[model samples]
Target: MTNQGFPRGLRILTAGEYRHVFEHASFRIHGKGLLALATPNDLGHVRVGLVFSKKNVRRAVDRNRLKRLTRESVRLRQQWLPSVDIVVLSRKGVHEIDSETLARQLHGMWRRLEKDVKRQPEHQQ
Candidate 1:
């Protein structure tokens, strides 16, 4: 059986890594309660970072729930994503939404990001 866990390589762990995407975002995918900013990477695979501030999520448990859901969504769909670094930002009131709705929103954003990348092949190096 293949490993089905979130690996460290698929994560943007350092502050500089997150800043790289924030400073040079190639695509911005917007959802109801979330925003994903992406910048190209040469790693030939997708990497993701999630931002769920206390001001936005308000509760530790809610932040963890959102982070878990986001990570699962990314891990499952990583194969379909472009070679880029993505930072997912949570908006205020995001914790109020149900898991299904949040998942759906994330799915749409991923699809949108794929389409946007395809549309701008020149963006990729």
Candidate 2:
């Protein structure tokens, strides 16, 4: 459970992984394109996943940009986050919003999510 670099081996991408996060994880919506879900992982660092579906955003460039912004937002705030599996999903509105606004919304969302996570009972291994 070492804290590997972001996007190296720390993202939840598989179907099974998303299923587990949705079923067992706790989440909060931060903004139109920003949602955060947290699940207990044996790994001792926060792992992030970005979901920018083609259905939500048609262009590959837009999708990649959104994912990049999401990743950067999380990375910049990594120090404040707990060690958990975190997933960030992008909605249609994400493409229309500017990066500064998105980042601010993400920060606010993370803060609220952090509070909620702290209130949950510790996960059983």
Candidate 3:
């Protein structure tokens, strides 16, 4: 079994990584101001990346809050995720939602993606 612990390895760190997910995403979900895009990886553990644009939130404090919320949620649930690279993008109005609501929406998106990825054919990967 793969290491379920989320260390540095379980993260999309490079520009190319972000590009790969964007170019070859097999699963995608949009929720409120958040958009999650994912593609299967050969690695045995899931990895995630986040993108919060200033144009969307228009405030550094709100953008940081979104990132913090996202990382916390992903960190808690990452062990159950499939081997995939995921990128999260924020749109306008993300900061308006409360953290609990934001979390609920994010979790729902993850659940949908989990099901979608499982149903995809190997060729899609």
Candidate 4:
């Protein structure tokens, strides 16, 4: 099978999109310096957004690295994820962790979110 790229439709773009997921999150997980917020979407596919503030990562290089790792983690697990909009927020001390550790945290977070999404009522989720 051919692999399609991570297009705009598969991403939570724009401030409004981010705000919606943040304000109306149906599930959340806090692991290490990662805070994952998820809300069901009508698009019938999983979309992810990354939030790496200067206060958290300090350096632009670090922020970009975290973002890349987070994206890779999400992409690898998207097939099993529920149709939801997810936003991963980086907190203080996130810059200290390496990509492998960060990826592990993200994996755990996604598993937690999958459980939460499945537990929700048919109408709500």
- Write model 1 residue lDDT over 1-125, tens digit each, in one string: 44566899999999999999999998999888888999989999999999999988889999999999999999989888899999999998899999999999889999999999989868354
TM-score of each: 0.94, 0.82, 0.92, 0.94
Worst 10 residues of 2 by lDDT: 1-10
Could you give candidate 3's per-residue lDDT for residues 1-125 as a string of tens digits? 64435578878999999999999987888899889999899998789999998888888999998988887777788877778999999988889999999999989988988888889887867
Clashing pairs in 4: none
Candidate 4 residue lDDT tens string, 1-125: 54546777879889999999999998888999889888999888899999999987889999999999988887878788899999999989999998889888889998999899888998865
Where in model 3 is the C-alpha error above 4 Å? 1-5
In Å, residue 18's CA in model 3 sits off its true spot by 0.7
Give stretches of model 4 more than 4 Å off: 2-4
Assess candidate 3 and give its TM-score to the true structure: 0.92
lDDT of 3: 0.87
Give candidate 2's error at residue 77 in angstroms.
Answer: 1.7
- Give lDDT per model, in order: 0.91, 0.75, 0.87, 0.88
lDDT of candidate 2? Answer: 0.75
